[model samples]
Target: MENKYEDYKNEIKEGKRTLNQTRKELGLPPINGGNTEFINREIAFCRKIQERR
Candidate 1:
């Protein structure tokens, strides 16, 4: 049987999902001003994914 964690990981690797989405899935709070680094990284990742499409 496939593990849910591995499935989620694949979704992220394929650019089908974002960290913010995963955060919400896990019931975690969304990123905010206090997490500038996370915001910058996720934004850059999203841009890269968009550029490929």
Candidate 2:
């Protein structure tokens, strides 16, 4: 089976979708504090994965 989380990550990495869009698709609530620490972490993780390739 395919991994939805990984697919969403790829979408973000490829600029096919925004972090908020992915979050909504994943049934997650929007961040209210304007603190995107989690989103930034995920983006950083994606960049690392791309660099490894």
Candidate 3:
């Protein structure tokens, strides 16, 4: 059962579902902001995720 759920979880994570969902939960704007400031903010967010480990 756990394995099956993990498979489903991994499938969604592969599509950036978790990241996008979290962003939505925080009420943040869409990831594709289409500007230099937004790109920098996205990079910062990626770095924050990397640092979590």
Give lDDT tens digits, candidate 3, residues 1-53: 47744665685778846655655665766566555698687789999999998
Reference-based TM-score of each model? 0.51, 0.53, 0.36
Give per-residue CA lDDT, model 1, range 1-53, as digits (tens).
Answer: 88987888889899999867987998866876698887788789999999999
Model 3, poorest ten-residue lDDT window?
16-25
What ranges in model 1 sit over 4 Å off? 36-53
Write one digit per residue (lDDT tens) for candidate 2, span 1-53.
Answer: 66988888898899999987887877876665776887688789999999999
Candidates 1 and 2 compared: the better one by TM-score is 2
**What are the Cα lDDT values of the candidates?**
0.85, 0.83, 0.69
Residue 48 alpha-carbon offset, candidate 1, angstroms: 35
Residue ranges of candidate 3 with Cα displaced over 4 Å: 1-34
CA shift of 41, model 2, Å: 16
Q: Judging by lDDT against the true structure, name the best candidate.
A: 1
Taking all chains together, the TM-score of candidate 2 against the true structure is 0.53
